[model samples]
Target: MERIVVVGAGQAAGWAVSTLRQEGFTGEIHVVSDENQIFYERPPLSKQVLSKEATYDSLNLFSPEQIDAFSIHLHKPDRATQIDRVSQQVTLESGKVLAYDKLLIATGSRARVPANTWKDIPNVVTLRDVQDCERLAKRLDTAQSVAIVGGGWIGLEIAATARKQGKTVDVFEYAERLCAR
Candidate 1:
């Protein structure tokens, strides 16, 4: 009757849960995520989703029914602020602590904003999760030009989307070549 706690509902967390279930681990599975949305793929955030060719519904890792069938507990829109090794529990921002026999941390990274001045701009955004994607998509609807600070996978994908939408694109990369880092 062990309880497995997974922090971050990214691909790794989803994989961990599915693997446990596939292996016939009849234990309690709990997932904690800061995002309000459920487990979904991240790659599309830059490509199809940004271009309006695909939606989050199409990128869902598992449906609500599927999650329910697995009997997995989802605690979302809340972050795990601390992990107590001695107590074997995860403390969430909601002040709820979940005791666990095993734990997994798969929280993904966030986009870094090199220029602080861009934050003040209404249209300037960092593409990260679903929310950011949606905001950028909306902003792009009436945008005539787009300035991408980086030339990484996400940045390039966004630039492609912008070009497809007939918007002018300017990419700024610190590296000599695109996606060098």
Candidate 2:
């Protein structure tokens, strides 16, 4: 039987799997993700999860039952290092080669943290995924004052979550205004 490989287990990858099943593709389906955990919504990482109002469970895109029903094979805590176009194979970080008749790459972008600065700081955090949300949420819970380096949506959202928890928030934006133009 042929196999379909979907890279990056974010929202797009999750949707791709669902769409494939809904479209009547019966081939073996495989999802590759660098994250060890299962797929979850990213938006919640900055808002609900960071606010401590929601847990990782609340942001899950699909349950184990749903995944089993679709017969989707999940390869996680691993990354696709290279792709062999001629052979249609994906080489994972662990040197495992996944043969696929079709492939989908949905790896999303990451939060850009400036180098030579706050990134090395122990308390500095970025809200991009569930793990990030969990770490920052824990820090915010005991923080009396919070300083957000950016004024983008995620930063503002974090600010709001922090304030909701009764912590003072200071947002630093390089641009004249917050958010993207």
Candidate 3:
């Protein structure tokens, strides 16, 4: 059987697995993710997820039962350290080596926090994951006024959610207009 390994556990990765199954490719499928949490919807992380309008359980893209049904082997909280394309081997941080006939690299992007920034300051946050949203939501409860540094979609979404929660929000955009990049 073909051995397939998918790096990164996100919406796209999940879809790829489903597509493979639909195509009737019966192979060994392995999914590796650095996140310990199960796959969940990303859009709601900055909106409903953070606002308590949605729960983590409700945001899951696939349930444990689904994973079992599909026979997907999930390696959580594990990061891929190196890839030997010539040999078709992937070295993980956990010292596990995965050999694959076909590989998919779906490593997602990270949040861009400015260098020399005052991230240590209280009530300052950037939303990227479920944990981030949860932490930001807690901060919002105690913050009367919040100065959001970006006017991008995430910042704007958080601003809207914060407003709905009755917190005064001031969005700071370095560009001429909001999200004018």
Candidate 4:
């Protein structure tokens, strides 16, 4: 039987798995992710999640029942430390190795945190995943003002949510114009 492994169980990975099954690929489908929560849309993290308009559960791309129905092997809270091309194997942080006839890497992007002391600050937050959004949401609840470093889509989204929450928001962008490419 053919075996396929997907690194990262985010939105893209979820879709890829679903599409594969839909297209009649009958084989072992394995997904490895560092996050406990899998198959969630990131767009709502800044909007609905931050504003308390949407629950955390609402961000899931596929339900637990749906995942089980798809027969997808989801290894949660697990990180793939190495990929040996010669052996066609993926080694996880937990020391388990998954042999894959095909490998798909959809790890997605992260918040580009600058090398600074900001990471040490408790109040300073970055939005990349659900946990980050949750922390920022809690902080925004009591914050009188919000200082956002980036003017990208994520930053602007957070800024918009903060404004709706009646907080003073200042957005600092690297380029002269906001969201400059």
Candidate 5:
């Protein structure tokens, strides 16, 4: 049996696995992700999740049952540390090595952390994972105004959500206009 290893269990990886199954590539599918949660969407994190309009559970792209039905080995709380192309193997942070006939690297972008100068400031927080959303949501309840740093889609989403919550919002964009990216 052919073995296929997928690094990263985000939306892209989820879609890829479904497409492969649809295309009749019935090989072993092993998905490795850093997060413990199942395949989930990120777009809602900035808006619905933070605004308390939607729960984080609603973001799941694939349920545990669907993943199990597909015979996908989901490895969580682990990151791919190295890929030995010559050996056709991937080494994970947990010291687990997987051999694969085909590999897909769908590792998405990491949340950019603020500069060290902003570290000491308690008001400066980043929105990325579920915990961040929970923390920010609580903070928004007590905040009167907010200054968002980016003008991109995520930043815009956050600003809009904050405004909906009745908080004064000021967006700071390095670009001349909004939605630069």
Candidate 6:
């Protein structure tokens, strides 16, 4: 059977797997994710999840039962270290290797906070994942004022959420306007 391996367990990766099945590719399917959580909605991380409007349990794109029913093998909390193009094998951090007839790389982008920024501070945080939002929400409870470094979508979204929580937010942008491209 044709074996398909997808590296990264984000929304795109989940969608690709579903699409492959919908397209009638009845081969072995494997999904690898560095995160322990299953594929969940990312947009909510900055909005509902960050604001405590939704919990991690409710943000899941697919439940464990559904994954099992669909026969989609999940390798959570595992990172892909390297890819052997010639041998068609993917090496993981746990010393496990998966060979694939078709491979998909659906790794999502991370929050691009500069290394020199105030990221090292205790209360300062970024809204990227569920854990990040949960931590930031907890910090917002104690933070009187929040200084957001970026003026991008995520920064602005978090700023709005923080503002709703009654915290004063200051957005720091190197460029003239917000989200300057």
User: How does each model score on TM-score?
Assistant: 0.93, 0.91, 0.89, 0.95, 0.89, 0.90
Candidate 3 residue lDDT tens string, 139-180: 988888888888988888899988998999898888888867
Tens digit of per-residue lDDT, candidate 1, span 1-181? 9999999998778778888888999999999999988678999989998887898889889888877777888898899999999999999999999999999998988778877887888878998899999899998999999999999999999999999999999999999899998
TM-score of 4: 0.95
Candidates in order have lDDT scores of 0.90, 0.86, 0.84, 0.90, 0.88, 0.84
Misplaced by over 4 Å in model 1 are 115-121
Worst 10 residues of 3 by lDDT: 114-123
| Model 6 C-alpha lDDT per residue in residues 57-122, reported as the tens digit of each score | 887887777666667888878999999999999999999999999899988887776785667877
Where does the lowest 10-residue lDDT sum fall in candidate 5?
111-120
For candidate 1, the lDDT comes to 0.90
Per residue, candidate 5 scores C-alpha lDDT tens digits across 81-155 of 999999999999999999999999998887664577785688888886777787788889999999998889999
- Of the pair 1 and 4, which is ahead by lDDT? 4
Strongest candidate by TM-score: 4
Name every residue pair that clashes in candidate 1: none
Off-target runs (Cα >4 Å) in candidate 6 are: 116-120
Q: Over the full model, what C-alpha lDDT does candidate 6 score relative to the true structure?
A: 0.84
**Angstrom error at residue 132, model 3:** 1.4
Instruction: Report model 2's TM-score to 2 decimal places.
Output: 0.91
Instruction: List runs of model 3 lying over 4 Å from the truth.
Output: 116-123
After TM-score superposition, the amount by which residue 54's alpha carbon in candidate 6 deviates from its true location, in angstroms, is 2.0
Off by over 4 Å in 5: 113-122
